[model samples]
Target chain A: MVQASSQVWSQQIIDDIHAKADLGRYRIRGFSTFQKVTHFDDLTFLSTGLTRFPLEGYKEKCSTQVTLGARYASEPLVLETPVYITGMSYGALSVSAKTALGKAASMVGSASCTGDGGMLPAEREASDKLIYQVLPSRYGFNPHHLLEAQAAEIVVGQGAKPGTGGMLMGVKVLDHIAESRDLPSGIDQRSPARHPDWLGPDDLAVKIEQIREATDGRIPVSVKLGACRVTDDVKLAAKAGADIVVVDSMLAGTGASGEALLDHSGIPTVPSIVMAREALRDMGLYGTVSLVASGGIRSGADMAKALALGADACAIGIGALVALNCNRDIPEADFESEVGVSAGQCHHCQTGKCPVGIATQDPELEKRLDSSEGADRVANFLNSMTMEAALLTRSLGKGDVRSLEPEDMVALTIEASAMARIPLVGTNKVFGWD
Target chain B: MVSLDAHSLSARELNQAIKKAALTGSQITILNPQARHNIAVGILDSCKIDIDGSVGYYAASLMDGPEVNIDGNAGWALGENLMSGKIVLTKDAGASVAASMRGGDIVVGGNAGARAGISMKGGTLLIGGNAGFLTGFMMQKGRIVVCGDVGDAVGDSMYEGVIYVGGDIGSLGADAKIIEPSETDLIELWGLLEQSGINDRPRFRKIVSQKKLYHFDNLERLEMSAV
Candidate 1:
């Protein structure tokens, strides 16, 4: 091939953008298609479910607008996209990390959630729409704080370790976190698994009512649940009058807690989405309440896949933290030496002594992170994911991210295929398909 | 003496009296109270409430600013979602005594039921006697102290908080540890006992979680790793 001038190459790149001015309908065939298969012709079905069938007479219809973004289970709270961030506790992350996540989520027009560790003034300052989580640990809970929490979530459970309490190690407990949580500085903070009131569903309803009355019905309330009996729990939550339901998967990120990591319960994200959809449909509350799925969603494709499986959106905790330069700038050898893991296995961030120091509370180590710059990186990553999602939607012949569906995905695991009750890619039969 | 027991008074009427007094600014003293769930639920104003007898569930759920005292035993979630106020139980308390309480002080003279002080965010829970199973199970912030024995699964999934127990702990639940009580814990517990007029602070064994087991599962093999 003949070498082209640098100017010509630049022009070609510009021309590519113009040529595909509407990149929504463009596909990359195998990689972008369901099952990663080349034989598939209907990419939309692979990405989004029947939503891509564009209502009949589309050519005659002038307005064919789809509800773009994630819908909340509660009436008033829906997000603009199917990709969002999960709650990462203040005690688990440094102030800089919390600030960075808040700023980026704000920039992305998505809500950032605060974990049970309590709200950081920095987080509140950086974020506009904050989703305050009320977990088994009622840290940072007060009338004034409740008033400030415009969006509230009752965390019934998380996927990483369902039915388990949480811990903020003394190592991560700085003076500020300690004071906010009213614990001895540098002492372990233990949170119980169950909420004090309402042992089961019936009690849960009463608690929900109490919370609603506490907020004077101004804020939308949702329930965050782990993906265990996802369908049943989702239905229960809907029956309990939840505005939104968050389903966290087993593989979702944990700051530390290697002990918990070694032993805990939570379902994977993919199966959880299907279960949630079924629950919502059974309850006749689909699209009425928002469904946010979380766990191991690393990219826009993963988010798109979840939406297709019937989730309104996906929330990412580990992915966002990782994108915030968590493990950056450190050599593989140094990481291995410091964290006692090889480069590839360095994801054991549960120790809180991050080799890069972004997740640690040690003052000397925390200095390594520049909050503003880290925030920019997170924002950039979110923007990048948005672009990728848009491109995937376009390629799948849909205009919005919701157009993506389980039909666009093929089971990477047989168990996943069974749990999701979806067909395996390149196959005509599902687990019980006749 | 108005023998207005919680059992006789409707949840609405009983609450109405407390609400009216709490609103119009008057002290409401109740005698022989019983099972009056939501007795002073969501009280926003400051008032003195004295219940001479035992009361039912959610005795003062979501209390904002009030002082409630129960002379006898109380039921579950006595101050379930308390935001502010002071609740004192002269006798024992039922399970989940102070679940998801935001801010407040709950002092129980006798033992509390299972899951007492579960998910307490901010507040102080002082139990002069034993505490049943799962005490401070998932408490985020705040302080919980049991002057006597604490039942099994104490501090099961706790994220943040300190638990001081004077007697033997049945078992250390998930993520929970047995540590030396800190100076602050000692001082705080003493102050709370004094504040609640309990006046009995003995050498207590401190049960804490090191935050290593951030999650738990009955299926998975438990790992006792200290990070």
Candidate 2:
């Protein structure tokens, strides 16, 4: 039997369908039919095509270019950048992963952040702009590391597991992590959820001030807050004098136990951004402070969309692993058999011995990853994303990401459109728009 | 011994001037500065310096190599990240003191704050008075001496180190061992304090980490299972 192409249509069928459609009937007497176009004059001389969109386009004329990327938050003490690397402790990954991310960040002229564990020599060496994280664990936190990083962040919370401390079990807490964090090798090292001095917002502010004092004014101090009530918490951070704020969405990666991940706390990406923006706007510091969005940023499109939605930059965690060959090259069946799940159901990364070894600290397995190659791949991915963003800007008839307005974006579903406050396609307005 | 009176300048001015000295590679002494936080930050060099007043937070953060002396009370973090140098605090210090010192000496004349010498790798901390809670919480390698009573959880979760408390210790850390004070402990303490020109010696109780603390508790239990 001959196969029929989906694009194929007969003349009789086309005519029958056209006759049944009211729009087709209405188009028969449209204004374009009244216009005469010759090869010399071209189709441009149509009578109905005399539309003036001001100069260039509606957006170029309506919107002025404010700053793009994250705005440095002086109060909450975070830097200006839309994208940042999430915290991947030294014990979680081998030296290769840290070096790769650091080199990639340096190549891209972006910042690389440290995790709760402590400062790694390779990470510090590779990163040009390093933001050292000081968690309740105080692993590698020292006045020296703080000064070396040129910036400091007090990790008040994480998205995966809130109201609980972080546990770097003895298995993962190897000799180096143990030595750096000053913990014995084989026992579980628990980083308390709350700082000894920090009780709440008010106390947290004082502690932040103390850290700032500890480091001197040279290093900017920032707060990494997990999204609980994004608006309220961000507002508090702003009021508390954080130079920048990192909004970790609920969908962000976690290096914690399943019980902590499922039982504790987290908030989705979209609403988190909305509330954070609202909080900044309410305080009249929306444009003044930079907001770095983390969690579930898969592609450059996602990055562009987040930027358009007011994220300074998007931070990636799992995607970074994907770039480092987390699930690549393995036989699909072997991966399925070994992990006891198909590639599609592979969320068992919390277990350090990932079949691909991307999350493990084992030397033999970790050696499978080459830092230079992995860094190049990550760089290539980031470059591609930047190119995609440029193309999106070009499509919208704009030059930079800042020109993207809420009007330029539309969501696929009505609820999403409402939540994002963008117009639905063909509707030309928001859901309740007049 | 260069006598530079820092009392003539404000805390900010004094720090700027002394840090400028570090930049100029000048070995100078700061006399009676009574300086506050952010003193000598970003200064990594080898110089002999002295301060005669109570200093504030991060006295010598990431201090590379310079002999620093605090003649009075230090607010917090006496010699954080002392890369290679000597710091003598003649008075009490605040919390997280010497949180992660790589190589250096920190001598405290009075009580220390909570989590003092938290992650000291290679350094010596001498506290004349009591040490607060979680002293040497995650100590890797180093020597910490508290002349007076220590608070709860001394050397909790320590990796490896020698801690000497002249008075009563609240408790040994999870993996820390309470060893009898060794002569080596007294010698090191005496050497550090005496080098800094203190030279005061008192009896001390020694504590060190039991290497087994680093193993995974659950994994160890599983490993011990008989098939």
Candidate 3:
């Protein structure tokens, strides 16, 4: 008998091949990348010791508020916290989940995005400030909805699956979702990769102008890019006249995606922020163009690290989903029976049998999650994150979150030192850059 | 009637003025447009607008209910995302004319560039002259009537819509199939052309979705059961 080596071809790789042999195509799954990369965890905060004096962590008024996209728009998006919920489409998520997220954002005085699936009127009513996403699919995109938004995000690409469109199985494409998207029901929907009208950055510039015109120049226009070529893409987007540029790294989550893209595409979140910040600073548009970073922000520490890496604001998806009990074992749901996996191990969002009811459109499963209760939990989570970030800012002797700069942090790992462009701990040498 | 010279006002100022005029339901005329982008955008009211010269990208776009007339040429994405309106263009239009229009009638007297009526949700786009490549590409639910020839890959990957081509076909797009039009479909095409004052009786071929790409080929046991 031949011994199978795990390095050359692991058991999981063999199983993946067997599955593809049976399925005849690339496998689809959900959640963020399974491929481990250097992340925010690799960076460590250097609190006030001898060089700086620490403020009272409990009492210091460390402001977490941030203003985004004040360059061109008459009104910019102001959030009480530096963290906001990222765009997760209604079709990809249950309407109940969308409502809860909107309500939670409103509770925290932060912004919630309308995602790819247009504006849910309920979500609009729930969210005091909403960012309307103009995605490639243009699904359920209405000018009236555009008018209702506080900001507009033109999604050039996303971090989860860059250069490709989104895919939602037929099981989730219910009547209401279908009607809103103008799609025939019960068809596996693959969203178009390119915008219907515009093509390149030049065309994107014109499209931004059109959006500005559509909104009567009231709200800011943001350009969201998947962090594939962060430097060049950021420069082009800023040159294309984006008021805000969002660099969503490969750490981003998705409702459904080809497993290949999840592991193989785009740079990690650490480098994505550093590169995007440098891109803006190179063009002298660093402060003028608000930089929002997303992908794999699991906690307030991650958000703090992102801010330290030069991201003006951070967007969260999987963290918020976890707060909403995504992988939690609820009494009514037998995750093993329904999804053939344990609660914490499940990444079966593509199957539409989400035991927690956050990702599923099934009415019976949807009953498991109460929107109001879910909103409360998410609100609490957002508040806790705010406090933790403020605590860190105060510990660093910074009165405001914006004052938490790269100089306040050091890299724990050599990879992080290079990617974050910060000095390594113990030795004052910056890797790769030095 | 109110006449606003495009030479004097920026696109923002012109649109703001147009909105103000749209409130009172008045006729607005724009002169010397010089192909400036984003002219008369986001006017969501019942009114009439007339442009004397060439307009640029997104001319009369994102409108709900309005009748806009353009005497000269137009740039890209003319009448984009128009909900319910009538856009009559006497000359040529650049790429993506009437893109993503929901409900409206856009009539182009001259030729249209590539991607005309791309991703149209619901509307009727009538073209008197030829249209360029990828016409009716990814059309969801709408009707595109072209009286003359179309360039390569017309009606590519249309989900649920009908494209009536009166002249020669270039090539079909992926998941696009050409089917013989019914008598009613032909009559509808003729009526739309006549409504646009084309006055030409031309036999047309209809293009529709093959639906082959609607669903993925295979799924796992859980996905199969969930569906």
Top lDDT prediction, candidate number: 3
DockQ for all models, in order?
0.25, 0.12, 0.81
Worst 10 contiguous positions by lDDT, candidate 2 chain A: A26-35
What residue runs in model 3 are displaced by over 4 Å at the alpha carbon? A1-5, B225-227
State in Å the error of residue A323, model 1.
2.0
Q: How close is each model in CA RMSD to the real structure?
A: 12.0, 14.4, 1.4
Write model 1 residue lDDT over A355-419, tens digit each, in one string: 66566776766777778988888888877767666666665666666656666666544555675
Q: Could you give candidate 2's per-residue lDDT for residues A1-434 as a string of tens digits?
A: 66574345767458646654523221110000111111111101111123411223223432222222233322222322345567777876778888898888777666677887778889999988788887876665655677677567778777665555566555566677676666666455556665543447865665566555444455666778887788889999878777667787666665544343433356666667767888998999887666767777777667767767777667788777778777675542245554555554455443445555655566766767789998898777766666665555555666666655555566655655555656655566665443
Q: Which window of ten consecutive residues has the lowest lDDT sum in model 3 chain B?
A: B218-227
Estimate the lDDT of model 2: 0.66
Clashes of 3: 1
Best by DockQ: 3
